[model samples]
Target: MRKLNWILALVLMVPAVVLAAGKTELTWYGHSAFKLTTPSGKVLLIDPWITNPANKNGKEDLAKLDKADLVLITHGHFDHVGNSVEIAKKTGAKLVSTFDLGKALATYGGYPEKQMGFDTQGNFGGELNLLDGEVKITFIPAIHSSTVVAPEGSADKDIHDGGNPGGFVVSVKNGPTIYHTGDTDVFSDMALIAKFDKVDVMLACIGGHFTMGPKRAAEAVRLVHPGMVVPMHYGTFPVLDGTPEAFGTALKKEGAKARLRVMKIGETLTF
Candidate 1:
């Protein structure tokens, strides 16, 4: 009886150990903003527009964000760079972006100069091993434009070149591989992403006018072949009329294999 009891106890403990070791948290704060917490407790914020119009509790959420290890910005647009300076100042988080965009943000956008450096900045076709190899970030190309405008009433309000717009492929140690497709339309080269690493989750923009709509975004899903897909950058303004329901329908029409995950504003999920 003692031998049998010991075996059962070990079997139960195995599952709990595995679950605890592999858990990763993901939070969506509306628009294209996301907070990703790694299994090792590292925090990464991407396009942290925490106060976007789509989020009802944006202010509260922003106030509570006292910890951030890295702030990843994909472009120079006002919407994409939303509240990044404030968050970086408050949390002392390092900035991850292209060199030109980093320079523009620091010089005109009031982002601290000491927080960003070559160690964290890179351009397309380059990859950086960050956080002692806990995370690997690759700069991916995006078919879009980028321009940074200085804050209101600043000494210099001139629009600065924000370098090329791009996305990121973030691989978390012992966690999932997330591909954030910054503001861009469906392009053929996206198929190349799967050749390097299989994408576990894809944060895609589906808003029309500024970015691709439902049908084109579905095509993007087909190209990348992510395990799961999350639609973002929609319904913030009247111009961005894309809907998750429409995106689902388009995914079905395209025969994409990825599971559609439509996260609500200010929702968190563990993987």
Candidate 2:
């Protein structure tokens, strides 16, 4: 009876152990904003535009974000930099960005000066081992414009050079690797991403006008070959008319094998 009880206890613990292992939580706050919680519970915010127009609960979500370990910005666009200053002030999250963009934000964009430094800043083709090696982030290039304009009514309300636009390939220890493609068009170099790492999830922009549309984005997926693709940077305004339906049709036409996971605004998914 004692031996049987011990076996049963071990069986019961298996599920809990598996649940605790290899699990990462991802939350979307509309547009290109995402919150990634690593397996060890370290929180990383990417393009943390928590108050974007697509999210109905933007204010509430922004208020609830009281804990963040890192705040990563892809460029200097107002939409992408949304709420970074506020979140940094509230959570004391360190800024991860290019040296130029970090300096511009700290000097003019109102991000806490102390939160950004060389330890967290890097340029394209550079990989940063952050959070005590819980996450490895590689800076990826994007073909897009970047410029930082100080907040309206601020003393130095002028446009500043924000370095280059880019993306991130975030590899989490014991968890999935994710690629966040910032605003960009289809480029052949995107194929290089798969050569280095196997991406489990891809946060892609499918919006037209400013970024690639569904057709072009599907082509990009074919090049990167991620396990799953999440469409974003769309539907926030009337100008961004790309829809998931179009993206899906384009994916099928492109014969891309990646599974499309379209997340709703304010939705959370665990991987």
Candidate 3:
């Protein structure tokens, strides 16, 4: 009887350990950006452009960052790469950007050039796994531009277009796969991405004047058909004056298959 009791206790402990080792969480930092936390507590930050007037001291927030394992940059734009160098250095996270962007960071931004993990190179349709296959992030296509400016406001000759622009499809360990569309207009290929990746959560950019507005974004959500759709890239600048309320209304009107979710700044979502 004693042996049987001990065996049952071990069995319970095994599942607890597995569950702890298999859990994952995603946090939205707004503007087509997110942080993925693996079950083992490894953190992967995608397009961490976490600074804007709306952030309320968001620049200072970088100093408090901890456990940043990797930093993924969607493009070479200033907003997207705003604090990439600082966060990567402070948290000792690898900077994952295009080969050109990584080189620019090392040459221009004084980042650790050797630590960059170049995933995109002016094209798309590539995937990389991190943390011993605990998570996988795929680089997809976006129809935008890329640029990296030098400290002196001079353009770095080494700067490459790094494709037009892009986003990522992140697959967490035993968790939902999230697709982040980084500053893209509505395109027919979005539907193809949905068919291919089967995204679970989509962090879409809906701020007009640069990215898609509410109407086109609604079409994007419908085409992607994620389990949940969260609007981003709005209320940051005057040009991007879109609101989640408008996006939600459009989603409903369009009869999007996915649920529309609105999150406050610094909020997190778990699957």
Question: Cα RMSD to native, each candidate?
Answer: 3.5, 3.1, 3.0
Residue-by-residue lDDT tens digits, candidate 2, 154-202: 9886789999999999999888999999999989999999999999999
What TM-score does each of the candidates earn? 0.92, 0.93, 0.87
lDDT by residue (155-238, candidate 1, tens digit) is: 885888999999999998888999999999999999999999899999999988999999999999999999999999999999
138-170 per-residue lDDT for model 3 (tens digits): 777777787765543456545534335788888
Error of 2 at 122 (Å): 0.4
Candidate 2 clash pair list:
none
Residue pairs with backbone overlap in model 3: 122-163, 144-164
- Which residue runs does candidate 3 get wrong by more than 4 Å? 1-22, 118-123, 151-163
lDDT of 2 at 181: 97
Task: Flag regions of model 2 displaced more than 4 Å.
Answer: 1-22
